[model samples]
Target chain A: MPTAKKSYSTGAFWFVAPAMIVLLVVGIIPLLFALWTSFQQFILPKVHFKGAFAGIWPIFDAPFVWLSNYRDLLFDESFRDALGRSFLFLIINLPIQVILGLIIALLLHRPGHEWLKNVTRIALVIPMATTFAVVGLIGRLLFNGDFGINNYFWNLFFGHKMEWLADPNLAFVSISIMDCWQWTPFCALVLFSSLTMVPIEIEEAAKLETDRWWHILRKVQLPFLLPGITAILILRTADILKMFDVVFIMTRGGPGAATELISIYIQRIGFRSFEQGMASAQAIVLLIITIILSRLYIRFIYREV
Target chain B: MIRLIRRLALSATCLALTAGIAGAWTLEEAAKPYKGTQISVIFLDRPGYRAIMKMLPDFEKRTGIKVNYEIVPYESTLEKEVRDFSSNGDLTVALVDLVWIGTFADSDYIVSIDDLKKQFPNIFDPNYELSDFFPLLLNAFGTWNGTVYGPPFDNYSGLLFYNKKMLKDAGFDKPPDTWDDLLKVFAPKLTQNGKFAYALQSRRGETQSCDSFMRFIWPWGGSLLDAKFKSNLLSQQSQEGLNFRQQLIKYMPPGIVDFDHIEAVNALAQGQVAMITEWSAFYSTLADPKSSKIVDDLGVAPEPKGPAGRKPALGGFSLAVAKQANDNQKAASWLFIQWATSKDTAKEYVENGGVSGRQSTYKDPELVKKYPFIEPMVESWQQGVPEFRPRFAEWPQLSEIVAEVGTNMMIGSTSIKQGSEEIGKRVEDVLSKAGYYDGKKKLAQ
Candidate 1:
């Protein structure tokens, strides 16, 4: 019995080794390198090295400035604006996505809607499956002030065209709309799957207790949905905090830095400005914020579930 | 029989000598050792690259070198090249923008042409007359400090592309010859009933900095920096230029702040706007019947002069050998660059929708007739500012700041004074941090 158990354990360890190695190589190593880079004054253009291994030596040669890169971020107005914009994007987009997703999930959960639910389930995957960059391009076309379909309809309905991408406020809203379009379906599918796990007997008992649908949902379905909602909050918060491709592709943080999110700002600092240390510092700060937010979600929301 | 044999040998020797003289230095000979070597470069989807692609087959057939390239948009090209260089990736040929010369050279990401020639002397063609390239283009686009890093390939000069029919309809027989004329006379008459008089490609990137914002400042005798590299944006001439641009905004399309080169070109091509100050290379697109609605009515002219005489926007790219490439690959890349930019291939390059930097190419009567934009482009090039956008390692950072403030000025979100002052302050900060003021680096660079 002991020999058999040891053999099983060995097999399991071998089975998981490849993924663990890959995670270490692709994920953990880069994270550590970035963290190390954050501590130095690593201007890319100033670093001079040659030969095949030159790419690896720049980090070693970079002057250590301790926490000055992070300290500079405190006084940087553009960084502040980017952070504020990212938060505003989250504030505007999260609630719309959550509420719309819940409503869709509830409707699909209704007894007589199996065929509709089946079709919607398939259709909902399309937006979630679409590439983030492609979604941004689609958003650009959709919100184009001159010849976009959105403007055509806006002119038809509002009797005037709206400069969706030109106006800073409208550009933010346009980005939010694109984000919700891409991600609300994800929230819906998750919540819908959670709804399936709700015991039929418990639902029936709640219905008998109160003829009102809202009462039954509040008392019975809400508890069951809490776990899925918690998962959504944690995941979506992280995703939104790091949202870059769509905003970058669509606006490029245009119309005077209206849509420049934290990620986009980091890219500008690191790649465009060649200030890798400052960008690394900003990235670490963002990571810390993401961690704190995730902890809050898991502690408060998950505790209830 | 002996006399006849002697005559035959003499004739054979003469034939051999003629063949040797004719094939003295060819791309085929230079690329002989590097045949079958696959080199990679990043190309844009612009007319010049399309021309290169059209001519690529002949190059491959003659040289036996396989050229692989990734076609990316202009905005992404810098980042892609930087990432590749930083990682020592497989990019053999570096397609460098004019502004990137300082940065790429400072970082040692690309080898200088002289160094490449020294390293592989056998591969260089003696007949590749580097002097044939316009001196202005060679200095601005190809050289950094004192070293020639690459040869100018895709060259441009800002020219006013307008719809002749629209100008005629608005009671203007000719394109505006000055900024004052454009704003006061042509603009007021042309702008009406949802049609704008002009469109400036001002999307918040290098376009805003180089083409839109700097386009105004340069012509008005306003420079981005002084001889000491201090910000000159708060100067009287600069303020006048900014104010003029603001005034002209009334005649420009709504959402003009969001227009990129493509959008601005499309506006004129589709007759939505009367005129656009665009790069000379875009004439091909404007002339193509499939893309342009006003192909028959298209007219080209040098950009209108301001307080300063014709100081048009100068922009272009050069092809260089990547430092990361091995010797053989570097040789192949250099050979390819030489062949592409050579005076021998200049006419073919121009005929295939490319704007060649070779002065001799433009002087060809056949080429000038075939491409109507050539005369205006040549005029602009002759009178254009060399430092249109400051070429230095710190330019990318400074350009971002200018782009933001410039766009804000265009949209009326910020006053011209406030925007210009803000830009000056930020430019000082970037320059200070780069050690320019402290004399750690030379001020001239």
Candidate 2:
């Protein structure tokens, strides 16, 4: 109660200093640098590593071209398109990922299907374990318009082969499908772990209150899984926001920028267009948007669905 | 100013130390001043780089200058190279794709070795037969704005690779000689039995712009930009090429919208496709018995001509000195560059199956006899399209526009007219922002 007398022990401070310093160097410095760079007109060198960092700090040498890059983005259709695409991608992907995860967790929680559960659980982890880049390649192959097994089956069943990555909406759908396939297991595994720990007595009590499964889930089971859901939400949200490699591999922001997302747009600006100033400005904007969305994401994950 | 003076003095010392040491100063003696000095060279992990890496020990032993070479995947090589260039590291020299010349030159990221040739005749070697290099290739791949930046490493001229057995089965004695012949006549015949006539690189990347799109343009009597540096994509000639490509898609492998060099070449290697217009450097992939089923039956020729002329797809790399490189490192880099690009080493380079840019290497009877693609590849390099890609600072954006629209067109997501219009408008936007329309600057040559 006496405020623990500000226990400034060298042991504790040293114990935590390395982690704190690492966080400062790796996390904060880059954020500050990005913020500073976002305000300036700096071209990452063509030979990107040669001379951009020659000075004490690149920000000191960068031109103070404030607000211009942001201003340009106001009228830039591509940036807007990317933002809209990213939002849509999240909207489509999040629900499917979450619902599928929950469903898998429930199925896996069944007591009698240990072999099926273990096999399926192993299968779920396998996709999550694979690199996203490899997944993108697999996605590309699976949806290949020419010889893709998906299209081959679609031709057989639907009497038509869909243009998966070439068509804009289809490309988005394909990426979303891959996203669901790759990430649902993550959400499911987390939720399933939480489900296992939900105390058997509580489920027994809920069952007495009501034999209805939905009633038990809504009243008893979901509350226990909220923390897991929220954790999954945070991780998935962060991962989805900056998602680059999979989309890059699957679509490269193309089929006429149909699947282009904010990350792709930023990359195009910084690397392809060599407009680092604009890209940084756009990134700062994206960062702000991401931070704002993080709160909503937390709230949404924590709330009753 | 003081730094410049010191560099000049150091260069003088380098020259004096390495100079006048009688005839044929051994690589060891020449590198005495730079002994133990480590120089870093970065390039993509291709067959050519493997050849150089294999010979690296010999260089190290002779010069006493340890060589550190890093090979990255081709897709990320540009980003990595640029990342290296932006950092003031020990990266002495970088191998640049031809498309990067404008960006590198505009940034002054590389030292213009052309200017240094006269200043350090000893280092450059006046007896060196500069003209022995294919002039078209020299200008296209290694030179920028009338100044040489690097020596050619891989001379990639697009060649028509055909499944000889497939063509023979299809009752064709030879590969098509022209675009009309290939598309109208041969493609349909060969496309029978589940074999495609060609697998063009229609993927939305550099190959899409530089390989497939540009390959068709010149031969169709088209170019990327007009005299005023406007988008020529909407030009009649350009449309002809685009239409030709749209038509060719039917005969090409399905899902061509996703095919890059690897897929296109693989389709040929797997014998799923009858033919492909792939880079000469990929010759090894097609010839590898392990990867290719038709290795023995592979036929090669220059890209088929169009109404205007034979405009070969020009894509390759050159080894250029980084501007941030120290004097001794530069000297050693020049030495390694020369040795790797020299006629004698080139013979070995070709014999080992790395496509050497030197005309001599291509004309070597033994090499030609060994590699059937050499003669046609040489011809293709001779008539290569330097402006097939605009080679401008704005090229990346413009090329993206073209690739996006072109791929959409190929995939039936966008009409030829719509694709052409979109490409023209987007390119105009990029150029206009760069003030190309207002005459603030000329489009990069």
Cα error, residue B126 of model 1, in Å, equals 2.6
Q: How well does candidate 2 reproduce the true complex, by DockQ?
A: 0.45
What TM-scores do the predictions have? 0.95, 0.92
Error of 1 at B281 (Å): 1.5
Worst 10 residues of 2 chain A by lDDT: A46-55
TM-score of chain A of each: 0.93, 0.91
Error of 1 at B72 (Å): 2.0
Off by over 4 Å in 1: A1-8, A48-60, B1-23
What lDDT score belongs to each candidate, Candidate 1 first?
Answer: 0.89, 0.80
Alpha-carbon RMSD, each predicted model: 3.6, 6.0
Worst 10 residues of 1 chain B by lDDT: B21-30
Worst 10 residues of 2 chain B by lDDT: B118-127
**Cα-based lDDT at residue B39, candidate 2:** 82
